[model samples]
Target: MKESNYSSSMTGLELAREYYFQVGRPMLEAQFPEYLPKIAAGLVGDGSECLGFDDEISRDHDFGPSFCLWLTKDDYDAVGEEMQHAYASLPGEFLGFPARNTSARGDGRVGVLEIRQFYGRYIGAEQPPKSLKRWLYLPEDKLAAVTAGAVFEDSLGEFSRIRAALAEYYPEDVRIKKIAARAAGMAQSGQYNYGRCMCRGDTVAASLALNEFVRQAMSMLYLLNRRYAPYYKWMFRGLRDLPILPEVPPLLLRLVRENPLRAENAWKAEKIRNPYLNQADERVELIERICVGVIEELKRQSLTSRNDDFLEAHTYELMERIRDPELHMCHVLEG
Candidate 1:
C-alpha cells in the first residue's frame, strides 16, 4: 500500500487563513457580492488555534480547515443558513487537512455567526465592555482569545472596531485594582504562608503556597506589561514575552521544580550532614528573592514606595498610588 502522508505541518492559524484566502473569500465574493461588504471572516475562539499555539499534535480533533464567518444581524437573518451550508460544503480537505465536525449553531467555534453573538460567546458582551464590573468579571483568558487570532478581513468594520478598542488594555483604574489584588495574593502565599508551612514540615502545603505565589506573581507581571494573561497551560510560555521581567519565568520554574525537600532526602540517604537544617529553607530563600524582584519592579514603575521585601506592605503601598478615589477605596483583593 502506498504510504499516506497525514502529518500536518501548518499551524492552525495559517491553515485557516489559507482556507479563507484560497477558498472562503473567493466563494463569498463570487456568489454573494452584496453580502461581501457586510461580512467578516477569520479564525477565533477558545482553542489553541486561536492563540497560534496549535501544532501538528493539535490536529487530532477540532483542528482543521475552518474559519468563522460573522455577519450583521440583518444579513444573518436574510441568508445565514444558506451561507452556513455553503461554508459547510467547502472542500472537506485542504492542504492535506480534514474538515471540522459541524456542531449546532452557537456551540461550535467556527461557522456562520452573528457579529454580536460571536463576541458574546467569548466575552459575555456583544459589544466592547465599558463598565468596570464587565471587564473585571470577564476572565483574562477569554479576553486574550478574543483578541489573539488573525482576522482575515472585516469589511463591515464592526468586529474589528470592537476588537481594536479591547486590545488597548485595561483602563488605569482596572489595572491598578488588578495589580493590587495579585500583589496581595503573592504576599500572602510567598511572604506569609510559605515559611510557616515549611516550618511545620508540611512540604505539600509549602509547595502549594509556592504554586499560589508563582500564579499570582505571573499574573502581576502580565498586568505590569499591560497584557492579558493567556490560559494556564501557556502561562510560562506567555511569561517569556513580558517586556518588564522576561528573566522571571526560568527562575520561577527552578523554584517550583527543584524541591528543597528532595535535597534533604538526598542528604539523609547518604547519612551525611544536612547542610540545611530545614529542607524547605532553600525554597523560602528563593521565594523571598522573587518577592524582592517584584518589589524592585514596583519601585521602577513608581507603583510602590516601600524598600523592604514584605509584599503585603508593598501591596498596600501600591494601592495607595492609585489616584482613582473609588478604586483606592475598594478592598485590596477586589480583583
Candidate 2:
C-alpha cells in the first residue's frame, strides 16, 4: 500500500495512503458498505510526496500513514459521524508504524483529517470555488493541499471535478501580470543585483541576489505556462515540467551554484593580471547571454500587463477562456 515515491522513512502522504488502503478503507467496506458509493480517494496534490520530492526530513510530524475520503455535502451530512467512528477505530498501527495525533479525529495536513474538513480549511467553504475570482485569489498551496495526498474512495466524483477545475491554467491577463512582475524581479535581482553585490565585495549579498533571481524566474515560468508554483523547495522541480522554457531551471541553477559570483570574479581577476590567466571576456559574455535569454523569456509570454493588480483583475477572463464558462459576466453586462 506504499507509493514508490515514498522511498524514504515514509511521508505523511505515504502513511496516509497505507492507513487508507490497508486499514481505514477495509473498515468502511465491511462496517458501512452502503456509504462507500458516495466516497472517493487517492493522492494527486501539493505535498512533497505528491510531487515526489519528499525525503527523510519529512518524518518530523505530519509524516505518517493517511488518506482522504471526499464526499459531497449531502453525503457527508448523512454519514459523517458513522465514518468518523469507523475511521478512529481502524487499527492505529500498520506494519511497524503507529498513527500520529491530529487536532481532530480526522485532519490531513497535520496528523490525519477527513476530506471535507480539509477542503473547508482552505477554500473557506467545503467543495470548490464556484467563481473565477475565488480560484484566482485562493492560495495555490491550499488548493494543492486539498487535492493532494491519496484518496481511497471518491464515489460521487465531486472531488475529481474540483481538482480538475483547480488544475486549469490561469487567465492570459493574469498570467501576463504575474509573469511581468516576476520577470521584472528576476531582472532586478539576478541580472542587476548579482553584479552590483559582486562589485561591492559582498559575495553573500550576491548569492542572495542569485537565489532571489532563481525564485522569481521560476515563478515567471510557472505563470507563463498558466501553472501554479509549488512550495519553494520544489519550485525548480515544478518548473522542470513546463513545456515552455524547460531549460530555464538547469541554466539558472548552473549560474547559481557552478558560476557563483566569487568564482567568476576571481577568474576575471586572474585573467586581468595575466593575458593568459583565463577568459575574462567569456564570463562577461556568458552573463549577458543569460540576461538576454531571461528577457526574451519574459517577452515570449505576450503578457502586456504592467503590474500585479492589473494581472489580478484580468485573471478571470483568462479563466473563462480555460473553462469556457456557460456565460461570461462582462459579456452579459456589455450586451
Q: Which candidate leads in lDDT?
A: 1
> Where's the lowest-lDDT run of ten residues in candidate 2?
326-335
- Per-candidate local distance difference test: 0.79, 0.57
Candidate 2: residue 247 Cα off by (Å): 2.3
Q: Which residue runs does candidate 1 get wrong by more than 4 Å?
A: 1-8, 101-107, 263-280
* Candidate 1 per-residue C-alpha lDDT over 299-334 given as tens digits, one digit per residue, 9 for 90 to 100: 888888777877788777777777777777888988
* Cα RMSDs, all models: 3.7, 7.9
Tell me the spans in candidate 2 whose CA falls farther than 4 Å from its real position: 1-19, 44-46, 95-117, 126-137, 150-152, 258-291, 294-335
- Residue 238 of model 1 has an lDDT of 79
> How far out, in Å, is residue 257 in model 2?
2.0
What tens-digit string does per-residue lDDT give for candidate 2 at 1-335?
A: 23353333565566667767777778878987887776776665445766656676544444445555666667677776677666666665565555543444334443223455656777777356665555556676565555445555576777666666656655443444344456456556755666666655577887787777767766766676767777777777767668876666667766655655445567555535433223342323344455455555544543222233222233343334433343233331110
Error of 1 at 224 (Å): 1.0
